[model samples]
Target: MKYTPHAYQRYAAQFILDHPAAAIFLDCGLGKTVITLTAIRELLHDSFAVRRVLIIAPLRVARDTWPSEIRKWDHLSDLTYAVAVGNTAKRLAALRQKAEITIINRENVDWLVKNNTFDFDMIIIDELSAFKSHRTRRFKALMKVRPMVSRIVGLTGTPSSNGLMDLWAEFRLLDMGKRLGRFLTHYRERYFLPDKRNAQMVFTYKPRPGAEEKIYEAIGDITISMKSGDYLELPKCLTNVVRVEMNERERRIYERLKKDMAAEIAGKEIDAMNAAALSGKLLQMAAGAVYDGEGQAVRLHDRKLDALEDLVESANGRPVLIAYWFRHDLERIRKRFPGARELRQEADIADWNAGKISIGLIHPASAGHGLNLQDGGSMLIWFSLTWSLELNQQTNARLWRQGQKHTVTIHYLVMKDSIDESVMAALSRKDKVQEALMAAVKAELGKE
Candidate 1:
């Protein structure tokens, strides 16, 4: 098909062509893949600047999205690429092929760097947020060869999803520690104060006064951000909260577990080893079950399950997509709605998009990136809440993004007073911080 670029797409592609090191925080459905690919085509063939390019992305994306974009566009017909995934032999064979671009999943970055010579002159990280932790093996291995690459681009929708702390490692990879700093301890000391800490150990940190603006300014020069709302006429998105309450007996059991870290339900004993364990147990209980010492799920109440049943019935033959967080959530949901389908394999995704599945189930982590389900349905139900802002936003974008015809409605099943509420609150706070970061560096096409 002939490619016609939007004004913002033209600007984004030009931004990549101009800058050697850049970070583009593009919202979902903004055509980021095409933007980057257009620039790469120019660099590889037109300018003769970069001979070899590497694109590191999530597994499914590396396997499918990039190659599809290359094939879909008539302008990029000359670009040849090979995917370096699967086993060691397949990866090595792909690397040996005569291709201008090589695509590999993030999991194999360590192996690729350790076993082979670093040959790519330019590298693109499709989801730069994956390297938020400097201690990760992929981050460490890539850092070792950072200086060898002449050009680099970092792309993500949720750059500071967790907070400003995430930017340090991500920017370090893009600019070689020129923007944020060389080390994390220095970055933390300059911008953050310990929020949750003991005499010896600090558990969490909050930004110091004016630190957010300062940090944004530091990275503003090389970073450009754009939201989909500013560029696309998307369909309406509605978020509704369905609150469920427990009876006196169920409340007593939840309170016992919260206060003493141990409780009994259905003649099964459940105990939490620590605060983290207790939080998980409470979340499980809020969802109508808790895992006992034997790893067996003990039923606490069916409040959530009943609410879900109401939601599914209210759909009234319209397809419903459910996002679950726990293994037992899937089991219980499937048992209740026997017609529900889990969107796992390629066939399931194809079937869901074709309107063949009435109800589809997915986990937030699994559906976090690079899978498009907009053709399936517009309604998504959060059977369980997640603490990660990235997962929640990405999962919602699966249905709420561009090409979705109907108004997207997201339903959350929140227990009135439980860890479910806590998780929702945390995601909101983190989203606010991330929003500020993006707004501070929002892109203006003609000004710069």
Candidate 2:
């Protein structure tokens, strides 16, 4: 197919091509892959500015996404590519093969940098946030070779998932710490205040007043930021919340556990040590199951599943992408809807895209990045809610982006008067901080 870029995509592609070291902070499903690929193609084939290109991405993405994109489009279809994954022999063989692009996972970055026999003029790191920690082996290894690459691009929608403290390592990879300072400690000292601390450990850090603005200004020249809504003429999205009420037996069990910090379920002693653990137990109860210390799942009630049944039935044959948080939930969902399939293979993606499958079950963390499901359906059901706003937004964008024919309708199943409500509030607060960087995500704090 001939490539046609939206105005924002055109700008993004040019921005990358013009800058030797750059970051594309584009929201999920906004065609960041195609944008970067087009820029690399121009430099490699048109301008003669670059020869070999190395693309470091998630494992599945390296194996599937870049190669798939090369095959799908007309202009990029001619580019030769190889996946440098698996055992040492396979990596060596791939490196020996003459190709314009080589894709490898982030885990093998250190291995590649250490045993590298050849040099790449261009490097693109997909999901740059993966290397936000300066102490990781991958980051350390990349630091050794950061100088050899002439053209570099750091790509991620959520650069600061936790807070601005995470940006130091990522931007350092792009400009050698020119914009974000040369060291993580220097960046932190200038813009952050330790929120919780003792003699040896800083538990949490908060941004100083006007720090976000100052940091944004520093990266304004090298980083190109674009949101999905700002670029794509997408269909309307209708987000609906479905709250589930537990039965008497379930309520008693939940309260006993919450009040006492422990309860007996299915003859097993269940307990939570802290607020985080307590939140987990509450989420499990809300999801109709709870796991003991021995990793046993105790079935609670069918309230959440009942809500899902209504959603799937009302879809009226339209495929539904369902997100689950636990293995027990997956098992139960399959038991209730026998035909629902976990997205386990490439063929499964094809089947969903063709609308041959009635429901595609996916864990948000697994299928959150670079998997195109927009053609599969216009509806998604969150059988379980996640506290991470990044996962929630990326998982939803799988179906809500450019190619859908109908208004996207997202269904959330929340157990009323449970930690489900609290989780939603926490996600909203987290979403607000991120929304300032990306345009589509708006926080709805207490709508529940």
Error of 2 at 113 (Å): 2.5
- Which candidate number has the best TM-score? 1
How does candidate 2 fare on TM-score? 0.91
**Could you estimate the TM-score for every candidate?**
0.97, 0.91
The TM-score that candidate 1 achieves is 0.97
Residue pairs of candidate 1 with colliding backbone atoms:
none
Residue-wise C-alpha lDDT for candidate 2, range 392-425, written one tens digit per residue: 8888888888787789999889999988898788
Q: Name the lDDT of candidate 2.
A: 0.86
Task: List clashing residue pairs in candidate 2.
Answer: none
Per lDDT, the best of the predicted structures is 1
